[model samples]
Target: MLTVDFDRLGVKPGDRAIDIGAGAGRHSFELYRRGADVTAFDRSADDMKAVAEMFAAMELEGEVPADARACAEVGDALELPYADETFDVVLISEVLEHVPQDVRAIEELTRVLKPGGVAAITVPRWFPEKICWALSDAYHEVEGGHIRIYKADELAAKLTAAGLTIRGRDHAHALHAPYWWLKCAVGVDNDDNVLTKAYHKLLVWDLMHKPWLTRSLESVLDPVMGKSVVFYVEKPVVPVAAR
Candidate 1:
């Protein structure tokens, strides 16, 4: 499922798009399907390999448009390999909170986006994340788990300071918030817990079936308690003077 709405971000066919920290390449795959020239970059060698394999599979199946191109790269978020103004669109979803130098990562993202290019950044929302932290330290203590929680304003402010003009913000995945809470309460690794198992099944069903009732419910509840807060931004034509 997509946390950032590509339509709202104004992503178009033939756009050069980068999915930073593309864990399983969800956003990258979507961009490719939309006829973008897509790149999925992450530090994990395994993830990059998997993303490459998926890309190859898509190519064999003719899943992407003939004009769409895609590839995977292993790279750091703080020092992306691409040159400045390289991409027309960028997506950094559910990743900043895991980066210790999040501002630097933001700078890297902004540096690579072409003038007037848009980006979508998603992070765990503060309140629900705070509750999870209160309930279980393990939620934030793991090697690559979330190191920070972001209030919407704080994130937007950071992006603005890094040279992006924040355009819009929204919450997403409301139905999935309870899944994380349950995981934290039981055990982050304990997928066998009965309640967790049941919830997982429901989530799987929701993702696959997408019943209208649940979709409408999630649309209503997303603004209030969604787990991820997504912000849309554009790199201005001219960089603002550093304060």
Candidate 2:
């Protein structure tokens, strides 16, 4: 499911977009569909390979518009491969919490965005994430899972320090919060638990079909118990004199 709202992020056709730490190319795929020059980058070779295959499939199936381009790159988030100011838009969703040097990661993300370009960042919301951690140590204490919980103000301050101006912020995926709570309550990896399994099935169905009731409920609940917190920020454009 999409985390950051592309409309709020102001992504337009022909925009050069980078999805950093892209696990399965969800945002990148959407960008391509919207006629962006899209790059899906992640540290996992398998994910990159899968994303590339999907990009090829989309091209062959004519899923993306003619003007759009898409590619996958395997790379480290702390050090992106592209040169400075390379992208018009950058999306880093549910990624910074896993990085040890989160400040450096933000720096890398900021460094690659062009002047006046926007970045959409999403992280596990503080309350739900804190509840998950409190419910099960295994939820976040494990490798490659969330290493930190961020307050909205803390994240905003970090972005501001990195020279990005916050434009808007919101919460998303409220419907998914209970599913995670169920998992944490049962066991972090307990896929076979009856309740967890049932919840997973419901989540899968919701994602695929998006029934109206759940959609409406989530829209209302999203501002409160949403599992993810999204922030839209932009690099300031310097006038010639300021430059």
The lDDT for every candidate, in the order shown, is: 0.92, 0.93
| TM-score for each predicted model, relative to the true structure | 0.96, 0.98
lDDT of 1: 0.92
RMSD of 2: 0.9
What clash count goes with each model? Answer: 0, 0
Error of 1 at 187 (Å): 1.8
Worst 10 residues of 1 by lDDT: 234-243
**Best prediction by lDDT:** 2
Model 2 accuracy (lDDT, Cα): 0.93
Candidate 1's displacement at residue 195, Å, is: 1.1
lDDT of 1 by residue, 1-243 (tens): 889898898888899999999999999999999999999999999999999999999988999998889999998999998899999999999999999999999999999999999999999999889889988998889889888888888998999999899899999999899988989899888978999999989989999999999999999999999999999999988747742
Q: Can you write out model 2's per-residue Cα lDDT over 1-243, one digit (the tens) per residue?
A: 899898888889899999999999899899898889999999999999999999999999999888889999999999898899999999999999999999999999999999999999999999999889989999987879888999999999999999999999999999899889989999988878999899888888999999999899999999999999999999999799977
Candidate 2 local Cα displacement, residue 233, angstroms = 0.9
